[model samples]
Target: MQYNANSPAEYIRQVPAERKPAMEKLRERIKKNLPSGFEETMSYGMIGYVVPHSIFPSGYHCDPKLPLPFMSIASQKNFIAVYHMGIYTMPALMDWFVNEYRAHYKAKLDMGKSCMRFKKPGDIPYDLIGDLASKISVQEWIDFYQNSIKR
Candidate 1:
C-alpha cells in the first residue's frame, strides 16, 4: 500500500504483482488524458498529478513548497484508489461522475469524499477515469481552489 519510491515508475514497480498492470494502465490513462500543465510526481505517497509552481507559484496552501495536487492514484490495502480534488470541490463534476459510473460498470461505485476505490483491479474503468482527468484544466483548478477550497 505504502511504497517508499521516488518516482511513478518506481511506485508501480513496488505495487503487488497482481495490481501492476491495472496500476500501470490507470497511470497511463491519467497521463494521456490529463490536461497540459499538470506535472506528474509522487505526492502523499502516491503517484500524483499536480499543478506545478511554474504555473501556480503559491503551490499548495497547506504546504507552499510543494506543487498543488490535483489527482493521485495509489494501491491501497484492499483496493486501488484514485484521489481527485475536483470531484471533492465541484458538485456538478461529482454528480456527472456518479451518474456516468453507473452507465459504465455494473457493480456499485465504491467511493469516498475524494477517493474512488476499486477492490478488483480488473473492474477499474479506465475511460471514465480518463474523462475525469481531462475535465479540469490547471488554471481552472487554481481559480476554483483560490476562491473556494483555499478560502
Candidate 2:
C-alpha cells in the first residue's frame, strides 16, 4: 500500500478514494495559476508543487543556494492543505486572504504560518485562493529569476 513518492501516480495512489477527486481538482487549480518555471513534483510524501531554484534560484539572497519556501498542495488524513510562503512573507496579502476566507467559506479555515487547511473542497476559499495564486503576476516570478541570475 505504498507508492514510489517520485511520481504523481504514486502520490495519487496513497490518497483515499474519497479524497482523490478533491486532490485532483486542487492539483489542476494550482497548475493553472502557477507561474511558469515552477516545477510540479512530490515532496515530503505529499503532492507538492515547488518553484525550483530555476525560478527563484539560490544566491537570490546571501547564499547562492539558499532554500526558498514554496506554495504547496498536500492531502492529509483529515483535510487538504493549501500552502504558500506568501501567506507569511508577504504581509500585504495575509490579512486580506484571511478576511476573504471568513467571508466566502462556510467552514472554519485553519491557518498555520504558511498553510491553510480545509476539511473539504466546499470549505476551500476558491476565489480568494485563486486571487492569491494569481496576485503575484508571472512578471514578478520572471523578475525574481532575472535578479537571481545576476547574483
Candidate 3:
C-alpha cells in the first residue's frame, strides 16, 4: 500500500471504511500488548512500532535514515497483515511462535518470514502476536539486528 501518512492516526483514518473496524481492533490489541520502548508511527505505508532513533541512533541497518522497525499492521487490498520483525531476527522465537500457534489455535500458520496475513482480525491470534511483540527490548533488538547483519 502507498504509505503517505505522517502519523499512525492519519494512517488509520485513511484505511477503507469497510476495513476500519478490523484494523482498529488489531491496532488496539497491538498497542495494549506492545512493549515499553517501541514507538508507534507510520512506516512502510502502515502503522508501525519501532525502536526510535533516540534509543537506537544508528537506525535500521538496511536504511539508517529510518528507525528500527519491530512490528507493524496494515490493511491491504485482499488481506490484513501483521509484520513481526522478531520472527525474522530470531529463529527460536519463530519456532516457538509457530509451534504455539499450531498447538493451540489449530489452524495452519499462514505466514511469510515475518508477515502474517489474514482476511480478518479474528483469524489471527492476537495474544500470540503480543507475546512475539513482547519478546525483546529495544536494546536487545538493536543488538540482534546489528549482529545479524554482521553475518
Candidate 4:
C-alpha cells in the first residue's frame, strides 16, 4: 500500500462490489459519532476522519496545513484496522477502555502501540468501539491540546 495523497481515494474507488456494504456500514458508524469540524475523507490510502488543520493549527507534528486525524478505518489485504488517536495521553481513558474491553470480550486486545486491527467488521466489538468513540465532545480533543503541549 504505497499511500500518498491519492491513495485513500484510489482505494475507495477501487473497492470491489463485495466489500461495499461493510465499508459503507463502518463509514456510517464513524460518521454518526464524529465530532463537529471533523472532516471525513480518504487520506493516505484509508478512510480517514480528520480534524481540520485550521481547527488545531499545530496539528500532530506542528504541521498546521495537515490536519490531525482522529482515526482511519481501512479494509486491508490482511485485516481491518481502527486507528485510535493518542490514547496514551489520556491514561484514565485508556485504562477504562482496555478494562472494559477485557471485561466484556474476555480476551486480550491486540494493538500495535496505538492501533487496533481485526480481520473483519463483524469482528469489531461494537460496544467497545462505540464506547470509546462516544467519549468527550470535540472540545475535549482541543482541551487536551491546550492543556498538554507537544513535547
All candidates: TM-score: 0.98, 0.76, 0.91, 0.77
1-151 per-residue lDDT for model 1 (tens digits): 6899999999999999999999999999999999999999999999999999999999898999999999999999999999999999899999999999998799889999999999999889999999999999998999999998546
Q: What's the TM for model 1? A: 0.98
Q: Give each model's whole-structure lDDT.
A: 0.95, 0.68, 0.84, 0.67
The superposed Cα distance between candidate 3 and the true structure at residue 15, in angstroms, equals: 1.8
Compose the digit string of candidate 3's lDDT tens values, residues 1-151: 7656898888888888877887887888788878788899988888999999999898987899999999999988788899998887688998998888987896567799999888765677877777777778877888888888889
Give a tens-digit lDDT track for model 4, residues 9-118: 55655655565566666666777876677777765578887777667777666565567767777776666677767465677877887888778874457767557776
RMSD of each: 0.9, 4.2, 1.6, 3.0
Candidate 3 ranges beyond 4 A from true positions: none
Off by over 4 Å in 2: 1-4, 59-67, 137-151
RMSD of 2: 4.2
Considering lDDT, where higher is better, how would the candidates rank from best to worst? Answer: 1, 3, 2, 4
The TM-score-based order of candidates, best leading, equals 1, 3, 4, 2
Q: Give the winner by TM-score.
A: 1
TM-score of 4: 0.77
| Model 3, CA-based lDDT | 0.84
